[model samples]
Target: MPFIRSAGLRGLRATITSLDGDADHYARLGGLDPAALDADDILMPDLAAATTLELAAADLDCPDLGLRVAGHQDLSLLGPLALAIQNAPTVAEALECTSRYLFLHAPAMRLTLEPDPDGVDGVAALRYDVTAPGVAPPPQGTDLCLGSLHRAIRSLIGEDYEPLGVDLPHPPLAPPATYEAFFGAPVRFDRPSALLRFPSRLNDVALTGSDERVRQLALQHLADLSPAEAALVAPTVRSAVDQLLGTGAPEIGAVARMLSLHPRTLQRRLADEGTSFALILDEVRSSVARRYLETTDLPLSQVAGLIGLSEQSALTRASRRWWGQTPLAVRRVAQSQRTVA
Candidate 1:
C-alpha cells in the first residue's frame, strides 16, 4: 500500500522515455492512478512486484530501457558516471573522481578506497557504500547500483577486472538471476554491512588526459550537493544494526526493541521481504571472515570473535554451511587468487 516517493518518481523520469504501459500496469496492480505515481514512488511496491516489473521492462528490448524503469533508477545513472571516473588522471584520481562524482548522478552513495596492509600485499581497494534517507530501506537498489558500477568500470578499463563482493544486510532468497553472472563473486547476505572489494592495482591506471579539467569542474559541482542529496535511507534499521553490531552478540529481541517494534512484527516484516535474522547474521559473519582473511594477520579464532562467533569451531561450522568450505579453506583460495593475480 506504500506509495513511491516524489524524489524516486523524478529520478525515474530521467531514465524512462515514456510511462504509458508502465502506468497502466501499476494502476492495475496498485489500484491507483499511475499518472499520480512519482518516479521514486514507482519502486515502492513490494520486492516481488518490483522484480517482475524490472524483468518485464528489460525483456521489452529497449536500449537501457529496462534499467530506466527499475524502481532504483540509480543503476541507470552509474554507467556514464563510472566511465567518466575511469578517464581520470591516475588510479588515485580515478577513485577520488568516482567518490566525488558518483553523488552527482546517483546521490546518497559513496565509494571509498583503503589500503590493505596484509592481503594482496600493498594493494588498495575500493568500497561502495550507499546512504539514503528515512526508515524505509532502498531494498535491493544497493545491489543494482554496485552491479552497474562494476559493469561500467569493467567496460571502461577492461573486463578482466575482478568484480567486487557485496555484504548484504538480509538473507538470500530469490535473488535476481543476473546477480551471479554480473558480480562474478560471492554475495553474502544478512551481514552487519555491505561492501565491495577488488585489487588496488586498478588504481594505478593513468587518467585520460582530457578528463583532468572535467574532474576539477566536477569537484566544484559536487560541492553544491545538498544533505538531502546524500540522504540516509532506512536510518532506523541501519542505526539499530550499527548499535547492535557493536555488542558482538546482538540478539533479535534487542534489535527489535531498539527499532521500537515487537520481535514478532520485525520477523514478519523481514519475511515479507524474503529475509530473516539468522541469514543476516551469517552474512555479516561470513563477510567479516573474508575481509579478515584477505586483509589482516588475524588468527581464525580472533576473526570469529570479531563477527560474533563464540568459538573457532562455531565459526568453521557456520562458514561450511554458508559457503561449503572452512574459513581456512576460503582464506587459502583467496591467497591463491592473490598469488595468481
Candidate 2:
C-alpha cells in the first residue's frame, strides 16, 4: 500500500498513446483511472503504477517503453523538487536536495550518492532503490526511473555529460546496447540496485543556472507541504499503518511493538517531532480511502473493510470526517471530476 505521487507517471500517457496503445485502457487495467490521474497529482499505489508501465510495454510490443517514457521527462516532472535541484549552486547540492526530498515524489523509493562498489577512484555511485518490502520495482519502472535520473543529470550539467556506468537489479528489457546508447554509458544488470556511476568531481561542478532566491522559495514550498522529519519516525510509523490498515484500525501499541519500542517511547518520539500516532494513522487512512475511492470501483462495504472500518456506515462516517462528505459522495465527486477532465 505504499503510495507515490501520480507525477511519477508523468510521461506514461503520452508514451502509450504514441505507441498506438490505449493509455486509458491500460491505466484502468493496472488499477488506475486515467481521467482522475490526468487532472492533478494524487497518490497512486506504487505497485499499480509500476505494473501499468510493465503491461503497457507488452501491449505496445515495445520492450523499451520505460526508456521511451523516461525520454519524455526531465527534472521538471518533479515540480517544486525540480525547481530546488535546478537552482542549486552546485551539482552536489542538487543531488543532496534530491536525496532529501525524493520521498515527496515516490515514498517507496530511495536515492543516494555513495562510494562506487567497484572501488574505482574518482568515481561515485548514484543509487536508486525501491525500499518497500514485498514489492520489487518492475524492470520497466526501474528503467523509467534510471532513465529519468540520467536525463536530469545531463540537463543539470551538460548534454555531453555521461555516467561511467549504470547498474540495474533486473535483466535488460531491451538489448544491452540500447540501454548503453540511451544512458551514454555501459549498462550492468543483475546488480544490487539501480545506479549511475559518474566522476566524483562532477559533484563540485557549479550549475550556471543557480539562483539562491528561487531555490529558497522552492525549498520553502516543499517544507510547507511536508515535515522535515518525514523521513524518520513519521515515515516508519506511516509505513506500518499502511501495512496493517487492511486488517483493522492500527493501534499505536501494535505499531510500537513492530518497531521494537515501548508504546510510551514511540509516543515520546512522535511528540518530539510535533506529531502523534493518531495523526499519522488518520493521514494513512485518509490516503487509502481516497485511493480506493478514486482509483478503483470497489464496493463501499469492501472499501470500508479494507480500511479497517467495521462496516459501510463506519466508512461513511469516516469519509465525512476526512473529506466533509459521505463515501458515496466522495466517489461521485471524483467521478464527476474525471468526466469533466
Candidate 3:
C-alpha cells in the first residue's frame, strides 16, 4: 500500500473540531485510528487518510475543509522535510530539495517545478500531483496539499508572494471567490493538474536563517529515514509507538493493530530479534523526550504529554532515569552549547 507520513494529516483533528464535527467519528468511518493523525513522520494508509478528508468535508457541509485544515498547520508539520527546506539557502534549492524528497512525506505524491506552459514572460509553475493508481487525487486532499504548499512558498520567499495563477484538476469545490481570497490569485479548475504559477525570478531569492551545514545534515537524516527496502519489525514497531505516543501510553495490542499483526505474533517477532515491545517503547520515549527538551521551548507538561506521559512528574522521573537531570537542566545545557557555537 502507498503510505503518507502521518504529518500530512497534522491539522485534521483541529480543523474538524473547529468546524463542530466529530473528528474521531470520521476517522473511524474511514478505517483509521483518530490518534494516528496526530503523529508526525509515521506512515499512514494514504487512501484511507484521503477518504477521511473527503468524508469530513462532505458530511460537515464544508466545501473548503481542506483549506481550513491547511490554515491550522505550518511547515513544522513536515517534520524533517521542513528542516531541510528551512535551512536551504535559496528558494530554488529549497524547492529542489522538496521535489526530490517529497516521497519521504508521501510515497504516492509528486512535486515538480516546470516552465510556464502558457508562454508567459518570466513565469514558472510549481506542479503537484498524486500518482496513486486506481483513482484520481480527491479534492479535499488536493486542497490541503496545495493550500499548505502556497503558505510554505510565501514563508520561504516573502509574505507578499502570491501565485500568478492557480490551476486545479477538479471543479471548484467552493465559489471561485473563496479560492481567490485565500490564494490572492485567480484560480482555474478542470486543469490537467494542480499548478501554481509564480515569478521565476523569485526562485533565486535568498532565504533568511539558512545554514548550509544544517541543510546538508537534514538531507542526510531524511535519506537515512527513507523507506528503501523491506522494513524490519523493530523499526516498524518503533514508528508505531511514536505515532501512538501523543494519544497515550502505547499498548502492545494497539501497536500490533497499527502494524496489522496479532499481539502474540508481534511479541514473538520482537523476541526473535532479541528485543521486546517494552524495550522499543522505552527507547522511543527516551529519544522523543530528549529531542523535545533539546530542540523546543515547549513546557515540561507539554513535552510529557507528547511523549505519552500523563503528567510532568512522570517525565521528571524518566528524565532522571535517562539523563540524571531534570528536563529543564537538559534544555539549559543544550541552549548553552548552541549559544557557544
Candidate 4:
C-alpha cells in the first residue's frame, strides 16, 4: 500500500471545475476534509481518491483529460529528483538518475530506458511502467503520468524539445484526430508500453546549469531514500539490454555479464521474477520495431539490420505478424493526420 505524494493528488484536484460541483467530491473521495490539502504536498492513497476520478473521466470518454491536469504541474513537483536532474551534466545522466530514483516521486511505477530495439541508428526510448499494485491503472492516471513526464523533460531540455513520438497501451478515447493534436506528436494506442522516443545523441547534450556538487548531493539523498536492494533487478536488466541492442540483438549471456552475474544465475533470477531472457528480448524488439516504423525515416533494410534481420522483407514480415500491418502501412497511417495539416 504505497501513497502517491500530494503533488499528484493536487494535479487531480486542479482538474475539477466549479468549487461547488467537484471540489467537495474530490476531497471526500480522497478521504480529505476539504481544508487540509496544501496542493503541493498532500498524500493520497490510490484507491481513496485518484482511481475514482481517473475512471470517471475515462467513462465520460475524455482520455486526454489527464494531460490537462498535468498542465498545472512542472519539474518542481518532483522536489529533490528535479534538483538531481537539473544538476546532472547531460540529459542522459538526468534520465538515468531519474529512473534510479523513481520511488521518491512515483513509487507505484518505474521507467525503462532502451536503445531502439532494432538498435536503430540514433533512436532511443524512455518508457513508463505504471502497473504498480494496490490500485488498477486507469486512463486518466496514465495520461497525467505521460503528460507530466513530457512536460518535465521539456522543462529540462528546453521548450522546443519533443520526443519523436509517444506510445500508449490503451486505445484512444477521443477520436484519433483530437488526441493526436493534444500530444503534439505521433501517438499510437494499444501498444506494448507508454514510450517516448528520441535521438540517442541527445543524451550527450550538457545541461545548461549543471553543478557536480548539487548532483552528487542529490544522488546521495536518493541512495539514502531508495527502497531495499531487492526491488532493482528488472529495470537494471532492461537498461542493460537497451544499451546492448545497438551493438546487435541483445544476448542473455552478454546482459548477464554486464550485470556481473553468471548466465545461469541471471536466468534463474529473472525466472523467479516471473519472466525470462527470451521473453524480455522479444518485448524489447517489439517496443523498438513499433517505435522506428512510426517515427524515423530509416530504410527498411537498415531497420531490419538494427533489429537482427538479414533483409527488409524480414522486417516487413515481422511487422505484419506483430501488428497486423506492413511496416510501411504503419508509417503511412501515423502520417495521415499530418498530411492534411
Candidate 5:
C-alpha cells in the first residue's frame, strides 16, 4: 500500500472540499462506490489512489471530488482559525500562534520568512513535504496542494494580494486553472522546490488582535505535535527547464548553475540516470506544446515561441517527432474529444 505523506494532508483536506459534488459525478462515470466517500469518514489514501487511478483511466478529466471536499472543508475551517490567531497581539505572536494552531485543522506545514537581498523585500513562503512509504513515483500532488493553498490564503487576505510568483516541482500541465485565475501571475513549475513568493508587505498584517493568552495557547499547541511528524520532508527536484523557459532560452551552464551543480557533473548525472539534458529539455518543450495545443486559443507560432522554438516549422517538426502527429492534427483530436465530452 502506498502511504500518503503527512506533508500533503493539508492539501488533501483542501482538495476534498473543492471537489465535493464532483465525486458523485465521477463515481458514476468510473463505477466507484459513492458511499465510500461519505462526510463522516473520508478515505484519505484510498481516495487519493482511487482518484489518481480514475484520472489516468479517464484521460485526466475525472473531477477530483475528493480534493474538492478537502478544499471546501479547509476553507470553512481556516477563517475561524485565522481569526483565532488574529485575536492575539504582535505579528510574531500571531504567526507563532498560527503556526502552532494551524495543524489542529490541517497537517502542520512549515512557514518561513527571510530577508531579500536588498533588505527591502521579505520573502514569505509555505511548504509541506509529504512522504508515502512504498509509493513509487508519486504524482504531482503539490500542484493541487498549492492550488488549494493559494485559494485559502487569498480568502484570508482578501482578493487584492498579488503574489510575486509560484514555484512547483513538476512541469506545467492542464487542469487546476485556479493558479492562473487566482494569482494573476506567471506560475513556474519544475523548479528546485515548491514556493509561493510574495512581497514583505504582507508581514505587517497582524495575525490577530487578541492578547498574549491566545498567543501562548497557539505556541503550546505547536509544541504538542509529535517530534517524529516534524521530520517529514519529501524529496523534490525543481525543474530547471521551467525556470529557464520563464526567461529566454537557457544555456546548459546556466541551467546547471541554477541546480547548484557543475555543467559537466550535471550532464554525467543525467546520463547515468538513463536520460540526457537534451532529451529532458525536448520532453519539457513537447509537454508544454501539447498543453498549449489542447487548452489555449494561442496561435501555433506564438506557442512555438513560448516553448523556445524559433519558428513554426521547427515546432511542427518537433511535435511530429514527439507525438507522431502534426500540431494541428493533435489539436483537432483534442478538440474532438472535448466536443464529445
Candidate 6:
C-alpha cells in the first residue's frame, strides 16, 4: 500500500530519450493511466507496471539500465532520506539509516547490510531483492535500486571511491559490458544476494558534506511523518521477524514482546483481521524462503536457519509443501527462466 515519489518516474522519462512524447502514453503502457497518478506519487503497483511496460516498449535489454537510471538521479529525487544521508557522519551510519527507513521510500522492499564473507579482511555489503510481501519488484527495479545505492555512497565518499566488488543472484540480463561500464568492479552473478561490497574502513570515513544541523532537522521532519502505531504494527512486526529469522524459530510471544504487545493482544488483533500470529510468521518465512531460494546464493541449511526452520530437512519438507518440489529444483527453474528470458 506504500508508494514511491513521482521523482523516479520523472527521472526515468528524462533519462530515456527514446520514450519522448506525452507522459500519459508511457504511464498507460506501464498499466497505469497518467491521469490517475497524483502529481506527487504513484501507487507502488502502478510504478511496477510502468517499469515492466516501459522495458517492452523501449525494446531495451540492458541489465544495468536500472543502474543507469538510478545513477542519474539527483539527491532531490530522495528528498528527506537523501537529506539524512548527506548529513550522516560516516558511510556505515548512512547505510544503516537508509536500511532502517527504506520502508518509507519503498515499503515493499528492504535493504539489509551484512559483512562480506569473502573480501579484503573488513568489508560489508547491502543485498538487493527485498520486495513487498507478496510482490516482486519489476525486473529492472533491483538494478535501479542497487545502482542508486552505490552511486549515493560514491557521492558521499568521493566520486572515485571504488567498491570491492558486486554480487547478484540472477544471471545477467545483458552482456558483461552492461555491468562493467557501471560497476567498475568484477560482477558475479547467480551468487548470493545482489550486493555491493565495500571496505569496512569506508564505514567510518566521514562524508564530505556532513551537516549535523540539517540532518537533525531532516530527522525531525521524518519522525513527524511516521504513521500511527495502529498503522505501524504490521510493518514493525515484519521488520522484527526479519531481524529474528537467523537467530531461531521465532515464537509468537517473543514477537509480541518485540512489538510491546501482550501475546494474547497480538493474537486477538490478527484474528480480528482473519489471520493469526502463526500464520503471519509462517507466511513471512515462506515468502522469504521462496525469494532466497529462487534468487540468492544462500545455502539451504543457512537459509533454513534464516527462515526459522530447525534444520535442512525441515526446510526440505516445507519447500515440498510450498512449491511441490525440492528447493534446489525451484532454484533450477528460476535459473532456467533467467537464461531464457
Which candidate ranks first by TM-score, i.e. highest?
Answer: 6
Q: After superposition, how far is residue 270 of candidate 6 from its true place, in Å?
A: 9.6
**TM-score winner, 5 or 6:** 6
Model 3 C-alpha RMSD vs. true structure (Å) is: 21.8
Question: What is the per-residue lDDT of model 5 for residues 91-166, given as tens digits with 9 covering 90 to 100?
Answer: 4444455554454443423333333312244666544322221121223355455655666556556655677777
1 against 5, candidate with superior TM-score = 5
Shift in Å, residue 11, candidate 3:
1.4
lDDT tens string, model 2, 86-197? 9999999999898778888877786767778688999999877765532345788889888999899999999547789998876677899999999988898755557899
Candidate 2 lDDT trough over 10 residues, lowest sum: 128-137
Ranked by lDDT, the better of candidates 1 and 2 is 2
TM-score of each: 0.46, 0.68, 0.66, 0.69, 0.49, 0.77
**Per lDDT, what order, best first?**
3, 2, 4, 6, 1, 5
- Residue by residue across 256-310, what tens digits does model 1's lDDT show? 8866789888887776656777666655555556656654556888878777778
Comparing 5 and 6 by lDDT, which wins? Answer: 6
Q: Please provide, for model 3 over 19-101, each residue's C-alpha lDDT reduced to its tens digit, 9 standing for 90 to 100.
A: 89999999999977887877886777988888999999999999999888888778888788899999998899999888767
Candidate 3 lDDT at 53 equals 92
Task: Give per-candidate clash totals.
Answer: 19, 0, 0, 2, 35, 1
Q: Report every candidate's CA lDDT.
A: 0.53, 0.82, 0.83, 0.71, 0.52, 0.69
Displacement of the residue 90 alpha carbon in candidate 3, Å: 0.7
What would you estimate as the lDDT of candidate 2? Answer: 0.82
TM-score of 5: 0.49
Q: Mind giving the per-residue lDDT tens digits that candidate 4 earns over 174-228?
A: 5777656766788887654677877787788888988999888988887787777
Identify the leading candidate in terms of lDDT.
3
Show pairs that collide, candidate 3: none
